[model samples]
Target: MERFAALYEALDATTSTLEKVRAMEAYFRSAPPEDAAWGLYFLTGRKLRRLVGGGALRTWAAALTGLPAWLVEESHTSVGDVAETVALLLDTAGIGGTAEATTSLTTWARDRLPRLGQLDETERQALMVSWWRELPTRQVFLLNKLVTGSLRVGVSATLVARALAGVAGLPVAVVTHRLMGDWTPSETLLPTLIAPGETAAEVARPYPFYLASPIDGDPAQGVIGALDAFVAEWKWDGIRAQIVRRRGETFVWSRGEELMTDRFPELLVAATALPDGTVLDGEILAWQGDRPMPFAVLQTRIGRKKVSARELTAAPISFLAYDLLERDGVDWRERPLHERQAELARLVEAVPSPRIARSEPAVAGLRVDEHGVDRVRVELPLPPVAALAADAVGRLAPLE
Candidate 1:
């Protein structure tokens, strides 16, 4: 795909480090590798560009400059630290805000990697680390994560899959299902999949199938009331995650593609506690009793290499599922939201089983009829606050 080669050209173009990061992000999203080796390249490039533009990579630079590599590794290998490292790197560089920095890095990385695709994992890691050494130790760690492909910014797989499908001129549904198996697909597939009319970013739908672009101001302020198309979910202020129980094994991945079940033992236990052979859409929330704990409380539970027993006990996480993506070899994404919700509910409560969420009825319809069968669709309503069944207000919270 020209996208891979295009990104490589962008990295070497060196308009700015922000451009490098942006290019790198696109590369990682599509490159298709995530092991420690790949992680090295991704993280290394990430930190260098981030540090250069001024972010968390700076603190690492400040503390670890010319310091031994061992100490730096300890601080930055973990996911949580890696993210803060980005912000810190920018800060160190005297860079401000993500917009300017990310854009600069995106373009720079585009110019940095000339033969990026041709390099093997070890060579890629070495090249990234050496290049990062030009920065500082903290930045090194950040770059380590990047070179290794561990720059996790909560980008969703479905988003990349959509992008890939768009490039391929195939239905997004088909692309998404192709990735529904044990292995995650690479970001490089995107340009390969790009249909002639679409852009790479267009491939990813924040909320796919059913679409809702962000709006300005509070959505409750008459925004919902004006929409002829749209639906609203509380947008649960928690980690966006997917629960896939396939081949009798359950995997819980944050939207960024990090397999995070171990960090919240309760979640893994809770998820495995449900039915087998299914995929679910939900938020992993910090809970005490039935109500959700504040987003602050949940924050401690995310992005960890290991969760202590103490942490697990104090901040328990729960999967508040909303829809089912798969069941028994079926791809349910094309199914209406209502039916998907029902199937998701079935995963938790069919016959006798544990339930992660209750089925809340949502309107589903045919967006376009084809081949004599009606396609199920998600209906987004006008907003202010989301209402149910068109006119109901107080009892409803989404579908406005």
Candidate 2:
């Protein structure tokens, strides 16, 4: 816990990208694999669901600091952050103890933290207060951040990937890809991640999602090529996700690396039509007769653990597949845009589910030929659009 707290402080104190990367590289190289795995989990923007409520923490902190609830509330508002406020109050109390100085990050994350969920209110409060009194102020701050789901180190996942790539002596792409999907952090997972050979990926793993960079001016003017050199499709206002059907099972993952297979049961039914060992990257949208409903309609269903029949009827879900990443147990991400799209079209046609459909290119001034790019140059009004390219992965650059 102390080492990770120091690393967190170093990362938070830096504005230089190189300095942040160097700090992370140093930590990864020295920390035990178990600790490193958990550190990477949080640093890469993955979060554990909130274990305790903010109200509970505030009440407990006020009681522990022997301050009135109103005063703690005012402190929280002035500090503009609950975690920092709690840490500051505890530090001023000077209650830090030596007993927890050697607690491992793995011990706190894997062993101690999870026990809070099963504890009653009184037990939970006692346990939390004990921990706050014993831990250093920095660790307490991180603990509070974890409890409130507000732990951010002012770094992007791309930078973390770069640092890990340097440690592993592999491309950044490989490191990012390996980090994708739902995988538990364990002692051995780090070794597999840095291995030189292609270790078998989890059967339900997803490829890292490629994100769009903002363009400063008009996209067509700044593209530096003929207009037809690009392909455009509607930037579907829905959950960006990947559906993996392998080993006679289907898994749906959101771009945030959440396993959401059970959220939309209709997609699971529709995915049955897909062949084994196939993966599709696309959007999950709420649909009406022929077109998508507003994104607000989809939000109503996203929070439900079990979709009610009324909700299903209110907003039907559809998976509009945009790219094919795998087919028949083979990876197709390296193929050109045309080849992958051609195969995706054929596969979607064979599927019999109306909920499963292809996201075709724009109908106006668009042409498809032997090559993905058509020679005919034309200008047309652009809606929200996504550009697919043959790169490290089939990067879907959404133009806003």
Candidate 3:
């Protein structure tokens, strides 16, 4: 707990990326592997669900300090964060003596936090008070944040992966891939995650997505050259997903790195048609006939543990595959976009489902001025009109 608290303070105090990475690397090197595993889990944005509510926590804190409930409420309002307020009140009131904490991050998470959920209110309160008396103010703040499940400390998962990669002497891409999907912090898993060799079971993890920069202004005026170089497709308003079929198993991952295998059952059924060791980058849309339904319709299915037959029928989903990242266990990311698209087209054509298809191309608008300069413009059907600059569009090798 003390080591984690110091590391957290170091990370929280700095805005420099290099400093943050160094801090993380140093902590990973010195801390126990078990505690380091939990540290990585929490610092990399995996949070436990809220174990205690604000009202209950505040009441308990007030009881511990022998302070009036209204005074605690007023302090909370002034602090604007219940966790910080409690930490401050406890610190100033000196309710808990200067005792030190001997618990490690793993012990606190695996043994203490889980038990809080099972205990009756009185037992839970007593346990929390005892913890407060033993732990320092900084740790109390962190514990409160953990109990409330609101521990956002302004660090990106990418940075965390980069630090781990540096520590393990592995590629950032490898670390990033290993971090994806459902993973728990375990002694064995942590070592495997940082290990150099690739394992057969890790095939379901998705690669980091390639995102495009938004283009602004008139497509014709913005682009300096002819429009033939770029291929234009409708950017569908839907969830961007990567579908992986490896070792006779299919996994669906959202761009946010969530493994959403069960929510969209129909997509999983359709994915069976894909060949093993294939990874497709696509958009998951709520479809009605040939066109996509509004995004609101798709929101109903998000985060659902189970999709009923009626709900599946109502919000029938389809995957518009746009890029092929892998084929037959081979990485295709370094290949040009056109080549990737060609393979994706072939794969989609082989699938028998109407729900799955290639993204439709938009008609390119072209014009020649009296000065004899060729100008090209493409307009999308959706709002926040997207136009591709001719020079930028031409840079992408058009799929044959």
Candidate 4:
């Protein structure tokens, strides 16, 4: 972290971008014998100038600057910590709130650990997870964007983790996994995650699984045909979730993975029929006749842990089981898309809809949970995150 921080500090010291780049290049290339490291190999190659002169000049430079930042921060994350944190932030913040959320997160991250330390791998990871929970919606959004440091301004989660990995003598890949959480981090409990002894968190409610930028909002930004190659989806506007039913206990997690069972008891009851030791991705839609009930219909019953019979009848929740990530103790992440689909189909058949969504007494049969009333519970809806091919959504589309 000190090395990366010093790099950033050097960037601050320079007056010109070219000089800053050159100075960094020189420092990395001519690092002292004791300081010389393999990761700095980028400096020894033609990459820096190539990155600067690249057609997309800004992107290359941004990527370079952000790597260090991500490395520094990510050193503090781990498996159990990453998934829970990601789940929470996705449910709470989404992407629109990125910048504001980042500020709170940086502040909390500062408090969580000393800026400089001779810490080991585990200590660093614990630190990152500790303060992850305190972040607000905006901070969570910002944290999610840390992957590529896709945007230029804030520190990237990947870079933070990378730095941590480098210092702690852990594999960079491992660190990245911990930092790039499967669930939303900032929206949930990233603050507490980095703290100490916290485990099995639920994501934040009200946030979606992923935040998509509005392409139509700026059609002229070369978006006219950009979506053509993409596998389009409704981008369902509703609460994002992950449903875990294990050993007869069903847990409803928001995208942030916060235990949301009490907030929407109807869904928990419906989850009772699921096979023991199963994880399914689904939407708790405002249900009416097997279709998505209006979001307005769901508003009547959200956030209240206890619901009256009238409330249950008025807004019945349904779990739209989309994909199954785990079944019968098998980790199905590495399976091909078609294979996963088959597995999901089998699981669905085994569990069946009847078991997934129950009816309120006297309220006909199963209906999808309406939006706003309850939330959606996704499995490890992301293959990259879940290590599967396709998530609960449609088939994976190629990025342009």
Candidate 5:
């Protein structure tokens, strides 16, 4: 726990990317694999759901520190953070004690945190107070934040992946693929996660999504003179999702790295129509007949563990596949956009389902005059009416 706290402080104190990566790499090399796994879990921005409410935590801290409840509340407000406020108050109250007995991060997380849920409020409070007395100030702040599920550091998942890759002597992409999907921190899984090769077990993982930069200036200046090098599609106002079909199983992941397989059963059923080892990058939108419903309609299904039959019929979701990331266990991200777009069109056409369809393509509008100067124009189709507006939307790129 103390080592993890020091790593957190080192990461927080620096803005240099190289320094952060070095600190993370050093910690990964020295810490036990079990302890490092928990550290990786937290450092990657994954947090346990709030097991205890903020009010209860504040009250408990106030009682332990012998401070008035109102004073604690005021300190929290002044600090703009509840965890830091409680730590500061406790530290100033002179509740120091020797760190004679030590606990590992793995033991505290795997064995201790879960037991708190089974205990009564009195028992929980006593255990928390004991922890406060024994742990250092840094660990105390971290513990408070962890209990409320509000811990946040400046480090990003990308940096963490890079550090792990450095420590394991593997490519960053391999490390990234291993980190995807659901897996618990254990002695067995840790070795497999850092290994150089893929695990034999069936796992559905998503490829890293390629993102486009926002247009800042004139749209024409953003594109090269070539008129047949790019493909354009509607920027749908829906959840950006990746549908993965691998090893005779289908998985759906949102842009936020959430595995939403059970949330949309209809999509999973539709995925069975696709071939095994096919991966798609697309948008999930609510549709009725040939038209798309508002994003608000899809919001009702988000975060749901199970969707009722009536709700399924009412919303009626479909996937608007835009690009093909993988086909038959082979990655196609290095291929040109036009080639991928053609393959995507073919795949969508073969599916033949109302629940899955291809996104509308942007056709190039061009003309040639007597002067022999080639002129190019692009057309974008609007929603609901689906009419082409020649002068409204700016061109992203010319289609091949």
Candidate 6:
């Protein structure tokens, strides 16, 4: 816990990318695998969800420090962070406990943290106060931030991947892909990540998603050069997901890297139509007949452990696939967009489920010149970010 707090401080204190990478590499190299697993989990932007809320933290901090509720509120307002405010107040009280400087990051994250979420309010307060008194103010701040799900170190995923790649002597792409999909903190995670060749993770692991960047608006308005060189599609307002059908099993991974196979069971049924070694990158939208439902309707299905029949009927879901990332066990991410899209169209046509459909390029206003070259100076609604085969959106190379 103390070591993690120090690492957090080191990362937070840095504006230099090189410094942050060095700090992370040092921590990964020295920390125990179990501890490193948890560190990687947090550093990769995963969090302990629904553990504790700000209101409860504020109330508990006020009670623990013997400070008035109003003072706690004022301090929180001034500090602009609940975790730091609570930690500062608790530190001034000079509380003490036996666990100070002894508990490991693994022990805190794997053993204590989850238990904290399950306790009643009284038990939670008691346990948190004991921990508060034991840990130094900095660690207490980290604990509070973890509990509240507000721990932000301002490091990009790319930087973290670079650091891990440096530590393991692996390519950044390999490290990033290994980090994608659903994973939990464990002793084997670090070894598996740094492992030389293919391992069990490859059986179900998803490719690192080709993400989009924000652009001002319409690329056709001289923002980007020629339109015929690009194929434009609607940026669907839905969850960006990778559906992997490998080894006769289906895995649905959100862009956030959550394995939500169980969240949308309809997709699972639809996935049966897909062949093994097939992976599709697309959007999952709540659908009603031919059109999509309000995104708000889709929100109802997220994070659900089980979908009741009534709920499934009320908000049916569909995967509007746009890219074929893999087919027949071959990685197609290196192929041209048109080539992948051509294959994707064929696969969508072959699939019998309405739950899966293709997001086709908008061709309403396309024109061809007298020389028979396609003149595509169409208006786009937004500054488009495209997922080039080998690159992320907006960081595009010309279509081959």
Highest TM-score: give the candidate number.
Answer: 3
In terms of lDDT, the poorest run of 10 residues in model 3 is: 391-400
- What TM-score does each of the candidates earn? 0.45, 0.77, 0.83, 0.42, 0.82, 0.80
Local accuracy of candidate 4 as per-residue lDDT tens digits, 126-197: 433333344443333333323212213223334444444444455544433333223322323323223233
After the best TM-score superposition of candidate 4, give how far the Cα of residue 375 lies from its true spot, in angstroms.
29
Worst 10 residues of 6 by lDDT: 386-395
Q: What's the candidate order when arranged by decreasing TM-score?
A: 3, 5, 6, 2, 1, 4
Candidate 6: deviation at residue 267, Å? 4.7
C-alpha RMSD between model 4 and the true structure:
18.7
Position 392, candidate 5: lDDT: 20
Instruction: Assess candidate 3 and give its lDDT.
Output: 0.79
In Å, residue 228's CA in model 4 sits off its true spot by 16
The lDDT per prediction is: 0.48, 0.82, 0.79, 0.42, 0.76, 0.82
lDDT of 6 by residue, 1-400 (tens): 8878899999989899999999999999999999999999999888887688998999988877789999999998999999988888887888644335768889988888999878898998898888887788788899999888898777888999999999989988788888887788999999999888777888788888765553455544554444456675656778999899999999999988888999888889889889999999999999888678888999999868799999999989999997888999988877777888888999999888899999877555455566553344445442233423222231244221
Write model 3 residue lDDT over 1-400, tens digit each, in one string: 8888788888889999999999989988888888889998998788888888888889998887899999999999998998889989999888654536768899989988999999998988888888888888889988998898988766788899988999999998789888887778887766788887896548889987755454444434644345565556566789989999998899999998888989877778888999998998878999998678889999989968798888888888988886788899887876766677777889999999876788855544444566654433444555221233322311233221
**Candidate 2 clash figure, as a count:** 0
- Better structure of 3 and 6 per TM-score: 3
| Stretches of model 6 off by over 4 angstroms after superposition | 50-71, 93-100, 118-123, 216-223, 262-275, 285-318, 352-355, 365-400
- After superposition, the stretches of candidate 5 with alpha carbons farther than 4 Å from their true spots are 53-62, 67-74, 98-101, 210-230, 262-266, 299-312, 364-400
In terms of TM-score, how similar is model 4 to the real structure? 0.42
- 1 or 2, greater by lDDT: 2
